[model samples]
Target chain A: MANVLVNAPKTAKRGSIVEIKALILHPMETGFRPGPNGRIIPRNIIERFTATWNGTEIFDMEMSPAIAANPFVSFFAVASESGTVGLRWTGDEGFVVEERVAIAVE
Target chain B: MIARHFGIGLAIVFIASYALAQGMADKGGTDKRRSGTQDMGGVLQKMQDDDTANPGMLFVQLGGELWGKASGASGKSCADCHGSVASMKGVAARYPAIPKGADAPVDLEGRIDLCRTANQRAGSLTSESRELLALTAYVAHQSRGFPITPPDDPRLAPFRARGEKLWQARQGQLNLSCAICHDDNAGKKLAGVTIPEAHPTGYPIYRLEWQTLGSLKRRLRNCLAGIRAEPYAYDAPEYVMLDLFLMDRARGMMLESPGVRP
Candidate 1:
């Protein structure tokens, strides 16, 4: 299973910015390293990452070999209300993962 | 030149362990603890301090996920029995414990296996397996700030002595011992890399060299290979004893499990 971890605050202040961090576990095999039998490992990496708040797109980006294994990304989102923020990651071999977190604002 | 240096280092370790073993028998690893990271440059140390950059955290995160999922015939997860990893605080500091009435001092991995097999009825994870490292790293991350306290038990007394002996014995084609680089020549440069004091403060760590999280046993095997010696089996008793002695030697030092090391 494509394991992903997301970190966000349980509560936030109205109209303030909150930092969100997310990471996905993967080898991101570069297809450069030679396998034990001298065969080249196939290239596999997350091709795209997207984040949304309340079903509205907040952030999106494309990735490639330059991206390190187990990619981690952090971004700031203005706190407007309480709801769930979700993220989606797409990668080679049809790997897809989603993670969601909830936040509350006073 | 390398062979000669190793011989000198071994001699120093022999004298150091002999003098310190008696005192360490009671004090644990705390007296003058230092981690290998301490000897590293700022960039590496900072990378370890920052969670996002510390690749080891990825494994810990996986472990946290595994803790809650039900598995095996028992249909239970680690969280089911050890609820709230918050309760796991400082638990790693006192481990490789000889479970009451048991003769062997199983490390964190062994303990995890026992729980999986006996309580969860889950399949055992082989040594150095990613899952095992993940779980061990997660459990160890809880004790991050706690000091190591290798148990001083009657059953462990003989094992500790044995560990000390093996640590001092010359081995491999090079006839070098651990003490050579870690003790006698600590703080010196070896082939452009700094020689650390060989303490076990941060373990189950992310090594830049290995590019993955590994146990101290893996490092020990590397050391054996460095000396051109035949390595013991993965589950060898010698490894266990050496682990015990290293923990004791590292007593009192704060743990940095799932640590990042160059």
Candidate 2:
């Protein structure tokens, strides 16, 4: 199961930019590191992250192994109207997590 | 004459280092104590100050969920009895307490497990397990900003003394003691990292080193390993004693649980 945290303003003025932060718990293990048995721990990281507003994609990031564990991403998006903001993450081993939050624009 | 001069130089160096160590130890009561957070750079400190940016909050969130979820045959959750996590305030400050009928001290983690087995009728979570850490962090998080208040019962004196002995005793291949670094060299850089006073103020902390949340025992074990010393088992009483002493030493220091550290 994926443990994720997302923070965004619940309300925003129309056409104003609102900041959003998202965090997801993952080891982000680089392939070069050794395990207890002295064998290399395989690379396992969240490869992609995307955020959409009102069914339109607004923010996207391609992650790498250099990113720290429990990847946290922060960005801003223009609040066009009252709608739902959808966040998605995808990675190695077919890992995927989807979450959404609603915002009211006045 | 050359041999005699070399011997004199060696003696002076040895005495100087020993004096430095002793000077710090002698200044113990008078020396000011600073928290580990003070050693951190501004960026990391800022990271700790801000809740939304701190990664440790993720585990705190997990703990909040576990606090309410029901499990085991009793079908009772922590919320059924404790009401809310808010009720746990100031509780973590007085941990490593000697529970009734028990001769030894049990830290907050042990108390949680005791509650599970006796009250919740559930099995104890394994030491260092994610669920256990989550619950521990959640409980300690409530006590954040409160001062650490080690219990004043007289029976705890011996254990606290034992902990102090361990703190002062040198061990391992390097023959170094906790005081050698934390007390003597505190605030000084070791291998480019500044050493703090080894206070137990912030525990179950989120360390960038481990890239995960960990308890006080984990940090103790790490230091022991760093000194090339054999570490005590996870459930050893010595850890409790050491914890007891650390909390006492850090008395009046604000508890910063679920804290961020380098």
Candidate 3:
């Protein structure tokens, strides 16, 4: 699986447009069908997702199994200060993945 | 001859690169069967046999019961009005149908409204309500094993084509098309979650997380919101068209409505 990619401003002045693009590696199974061997695949799906900028979460999500696998999300943030933008994904197995990129304000 | 050779070489390279990217995109990481608690074989077997614990079956049962109950001015149950569901089986698999005098094929939601006005004498169910979802799921379940085959009447052709276009059209600030995430990049993890193939065979499903049932339109609305696109109304033609398109793509997948999802 590809690592979650977080593309955003590494540094920016306060109040500037901060672009955020995040993609994770997941198989977001809908859990409706069976596998080749013909078994009712138990539901294992990512339930929640969150993204925070310097500990202040900007985006939060309540995801259902309906979302397609390996979801990609992109949004904007007004840079208020220089800090690390952290992203996290919580799934059935546990906290399945996380990634971070530092943002600097001029 | 030199130009022909160059063209062939270019074509081969394009084909090879496309194949390689597809393989990388399709590697093991995206198998929902593997990710779930149950093993792949177990899931398939459970699907083949009717298992009570199967969350999907529970929803199916609920839908069946709802199909028989009556509540409206006409004082007619769905069974009383439409006759046995057996006659209506496989009917849902062919919706959003374009009627002779209508602009487009009425979607499942629209058909439900038609039933309400003509027989039940009640207002249409709200687009996102549980009652509507349950009924849609129960009705669609009748065609559980059938493949999705949209009606091929001439009036439907353009709408079907439009739906195909929507599936491939890129939108939102992310500049992503449904195909980019669902087709080209399926199975890749985004934010630690695997991206399953986008399929609509099992809808009006019971989501364990929501602890309730929902329809495909609600899910589509959510996706549009996630991507920052302007979402259409629940029963909007655009959504109806998209649903048809997706069902066609998901042809051959078994229906498993009222499915349980995490």
Question: B199, model 1: CA deviation in Å?
Answer: 1.5
Report lDDT (Cα) of residue B54, candidate 3: 39
Across B14-63, the per-residue lDDT of candidate 3 in tens digits comes to 99997776444334355332212121245544432433333444445555
Best by DockQ: 2
lDDT of candidate 1 at residue B218, scale 0 to 100: 94
Question: Model 1: per-residue lDDT, tens digit, B59-123?
Answer: 98888888898888999999998998888887778776787567888888888888898889989
Q: Could you report the DockQ of all the candidates, in the order they appear?
A: 0.23, 0.45, 0.01
RMSD of 3: 21.3
iRMSD (Å), candidate 1: 2.6
- Docking quality category of candidate 2 according to DockQ thresholds: acceptable
Candidates in order, TM-scores: namely: 0.77, 0.86, 0.56
Model 2: residues with Cα > 4 Å off, grouped in runs: A31-34, A37-43, B1-31
Q: Tell me the TM-score of model 2.
A: 0.86
TM-score, predicted candidate 3 vs. hidden true structure:
0.56
